[model samples]
Target: MISVLFFVLLGAMLGAALGYASQVFKVESNPLVEQIEALMPGGQCGQCGEAGCRQAAEAMVRGALSPAGCPLGGANLTQQVAELLGVSVTIADADIQWVATIDESLCSGCGRCYKACPFDAIVGATKQMHTVIRDVCTGCKLCTQVCPQQCLTTVALPPDSRSWFWPKPQTAAA
Candidate 1:
């Protein structure tokens, strides 16, 4: 009983010290980086030339990267980032985003594409046909590149409820 009481007292003291240290050593972070990271799609697919969304957000805040850099977020995200940074941007006609699709007829139940997906967006068991989870896919084309049977292909993601945006109002020519 005496040993148990001693251990409990030690644990309590250590916990208190840890709590105090955390408060004293708290690290400050840029609010703009946090906000930009929040606006990202959180795919972490490395398609934007950064290792992850947080790194990309830091780059954006540093002015080393453009707001239109994220392909996964598409035009809507570009507009949001531009607005946040107080910059004007034009969404190019070539800014179309693509998503991977498996041609069911060509699929041989191989799992290569599933293994290649960094986002875990492809699902299937070994020797079973794999399917792409549309919402989670970042269209990095990694799966398409690694498919042994060439069953995976990329197609333009059509505008849906979540992705659809209102077009900028047209102005008459001066």
Candidate 2:
């Protein structure tokens, strides 16, 4: 009975010491890392090549990863992350956004593409020809999959003066 009591006391003392040590040595996390993690899609899909969103955010804060590194978040998230990190990202390299284009000649106008488009980029009547709003299309290709006539095709939007960025000059490695 005495030995059991002694061991229980010893265990409790050790547990208390460990808990106190943990509290004393606790490291505060960066708020920026938290903000970046919250901006992620929270899929934990590992598509970004990180173990999880938290690790990815830490990497972003440390400059080990690019602000636009998360593939699932796409261009909008990339822009938000870039803005939060105070970094500039070129649209061509960062996103390479595509837009859906409907071939009027081949379209059967069955309304399948219109229904499948999540962005509401297609506009037309049920039986009439549909036109894709290039500005609103995310190029997800859902419309292409649902198109009965296979008329919806995704095309890389040509970079205009606004979307284009000047190439950064290469520096000599002195």
Candidate 3:
């Protein structure tokens, strides 16, 4: 009974403290905006064809940007982002980035391209010939920058994996 009483007192004290702190440090919640913002491809690549993630965020909240804005986050990320913001979404076609395809037979084990990849998506040992993992590949054309032999080649989506969406219509004809 004594222990229970002590716990009750402690709980009451903590609750009071929390309530007081809340009044002192209140923050407005922008749940609707932040949720959609999180879905933006973190790459900040602007390749989403948007200016930046935050720009995309503003557009999303205003319902100006489509799920199509972010190329890296692609469909899955866009869908969740749209749901959270209570906005409509039209998923863009899958854009498989043209990642480097390592030709093992031609591989020199030079590790040159490995140095060029900023995303750390390539895997291999030094002087032991590196390999590209397509799933993680950003297809930035950076790795191809370092290859002296020019083995790495970018391939357009082979059509099997390609999908389509209504292109953002031109508002003003030039």
Candidate 4:
């Protein structure tokens, strides 16, 4: 009985300490919801199936919506947000692949395009011919504008790199 009583007291003390620590270190919450609402493209494009980005973000917190609903947020930003929410997310079916293609023949290897790529998909040393690693490319088009020689081109996703998952077919009619 003494041992049990001692254990219970210790557990209560630990719980109280943790609760106090949490109150002391508590962080401001819902920053993403507010920020996303503010950053919304405001085209009022209800691509997220919600009335707008604000509604979609609320639904996301409620676990009733997917981040894919926000047409303006895109997959990259949405994925980062979903990670914070501890929720599963749907990948956006974005425009067909737009990987940056550098023409080695024309590439001056100035490294501007590599610096412009947001996904770090391009790699090379200074004065060395930089190449885009197609798989990692997010195709935000930032690199195309920065290429000094104007050698960048976006290509459609190859048949193989492209993913196609068919919806489950309905059973035969009775």
- Highest TM-score scorer: 1
Backbone clash numbers for all candidates listed: 0, 0, 1, 1
On lDDT, the leading prediction is: 1
Between prediction 2 and prediction 3, the one with superior lDDT is 2
Candidate 3 per-residue C-alpha lDDT over 114-139 given as tens digits, one digit per residue, 9 for 90 to 100: 87775676788777878888767766
Clashing residue pairs for model 4: 48-69
Residue-level lDDT of model 1, residues 103-155, one tens digit each, is 98899887888888888889999888789998888788989998888889999
Off by over 4 Å in 4: 1-25, 28-66, 69-95, 167-174
Q: Give a tens-digit lDDT track for model 2, residues 1-174.
A: 999999999999999999999999999999999999998867554657899889999999899999878765666677788999999986446456678899999987799888877568899988798999876766667788888777888887776664455566779999
Estimate, for each residue in 67-174, the C-alpha lDDT of model 4 and write its tens digit: 555543555556666776777765634424455678889888888887776567899988888898977775557678878788888776653423433334568999
**Candidate 3 ranges beyond 4 A from true positions:** 1-34, 49-55, 62-64, 92-99, 109-112, 138-141, 154-174
Q: Give the Cα lDDT of each candidate.
A: 0.87, 0.80, 0.69, 0.69
Worst 10 residues of 3 by lDDT: 157-166
| Residue 86 lDDT, candidate 4, scale 0-100 | 78
- TM-scores across all candidates? 0.87, 0.53, 0.51, 0.49
TM-score between model 4 and native: 0.49
